[model samples]
Target: MSPVTYADIEAASQRLAGVANRTPVITSRTVNELTKAQVFFKCENFQRTGSFKFRGAYNALAQLSDRQKQQGVLTYSSGNHAQAIALSGKLLGIATTIVMPQDAPAVKLAATRGYGAQVILYDRATTTREKLAQQLASDRQLTIIPPYDHPQIIAGQGTAAKELLEEVPQLDLLLVCCGGGGLLSGCAIATKSQPNQTNSPSHHPRVIGVEPEQADDAKRSFYTKKLQTIHNPDTIADGARTPSLGKYTFPLVLHYVDDMLTVSEAAILRTMFFLWERLKIVVEPTGALAASALLEGLITIPDTKIGIIISGGNVDLQQISQLLK
Candidate 1:
């Protein structure tokens, strides 16, 4: 059984009732015509903090005990999760500290600080953020809210799929971007089972995780069935640059997800700009990972109802144009 269940996602939905944005489910005529399938884009790019990270961040912070809340929270992230924790902590009257890579997107670093969190920049080549965060957390007696490993975090991240399926229940395939597998693992639990007591395998959509070819840890781990790790990957998709899946997330993803696919850096950029031009929405490289899989023909599920989770919209304007060239 999955550590996070459909009921857990439903509870998260209740907790996020008015707190989180019910981001739109968008359909593009151009995309549909090109792909020859009905596609529903879960536009989490428009979500609070400009990413689906807010759903899990808020859920985890909100459930903290009184003592934990007062002690404050600490986390490490490449970008979106940092901003989400900062904003969520501010909203919930909790203090937050973030350990971010020095080279994280300028926009993300700015947004995280702008949300009122103390930011500590680190060199990924020299040291890991996890070690820094741990030392700080131990010193300050702060509660550690890791980016995607905790049960509440996974359950909260699952709400994105819960909302998507609530709007359109009969999808043939669901594609989610995988980093640490927080979003993908949480979503897979929700996608695999019904709300009721009985488990029906036939009705569930095949949940596939999409990762950058440069950082294909999750993809390699999926088929190997053993934990895999990658060193500092040089991909434009900074959000998907995690070394490997987490303890909680690895098991859930291995158990629930149907398959894993990888797309090229060029494909991600092509898809990101394509959406900006076509959908008129600003999507970051990580946000475009899953969409690029189908749009760029990395994988094909023809003539079916497909759901793609657009994970974030926090674009780095400074890098966007230069990356295309």
Candidate 2:
């Protein structure tokens, strides 16, 4: 598969200018002091639909042909992407059908439905959501907007890193939470493709992907130099529990990403609580994946300016209360 180009990311940035939120790059003095690193948090939790997925979903939906838009769109996601597509479709006046896991968080399911999309729930263990969505799209003449495989989606997701790099041009490293590698690969492209304002030739920062240890498909793929799959990983980071990377995203990750790391469940919970208590943010488990790796000392790089992509803040309140207790 051809990689998503720098030009694509530039176009995506332009497309998302007023549509997607230019989420703030937050900094915490306590966090900086604890890690001894200048940490810039690209807080996508503040984004539309409470996740960076809005950038990609809106971008993809906006680019649909009139006829395709008339036919509407279909996709499958656990939570964030589902809400993203639902809200994007609602905004674009396109009908959306989302096939979500039956056990998906009730908050996300309600949010998706509240955005005026048809929700179809299937058992994650017994049903292949992609195949079900494909069949539905085929039967209904709906355009299948994949959660993370398409070039348009990848480019759209790249806008986050584009905005980040534009704001903080001198980052030493960028760590992204990886599910199907869309955000990781997209951010890698955005970061590596552009030269900073500085005249130095080595202005590009290293990009790393962080995943839950129970759902380490990207980590395994990075190390094995091949795509890998896992089935139904039981983890608190539900958004990062994807089975494998897609074709478009896998190649971009292989080519542009520097490393992939996994963090334990304990680390994930700890980091989530830390962000909430210290950073005063309600970062979901998946959103805290990269920070978990950093706080847990999974990556040993020192004294450098680090940029972390806080993927989302869509957590179930009941779960949060239980976990906090």
TM-score winner: 1
| Candidate 2, superposed: residue stretches over 4 Å from native | 197-201
Off by over 4 Å in 1: 196-199
Overlapping backbone residue pairs in candidate 1 total 0
On residues 1-325, what C-alpha lDDT tens digit does candidate 2 reach at each position? 3568989888888988888899999999988888899999999999999999999999899999999999999999999999999999999999999999988988899999999999999998899888899899999999999989888899999999999988988899999999998888899988888755455536679899999999988888888988999988888998987899998888889999988889999999999989999989989999999998889988767689999999999999887778768
Winning candidate number (lDDT): 1
For residues 32-72, write the lDDT of model 1, one tens digit per residue.
98989999999999999999999999999999999999999
| Whole-model lDDT values for every prediction | 0.92, 0.91
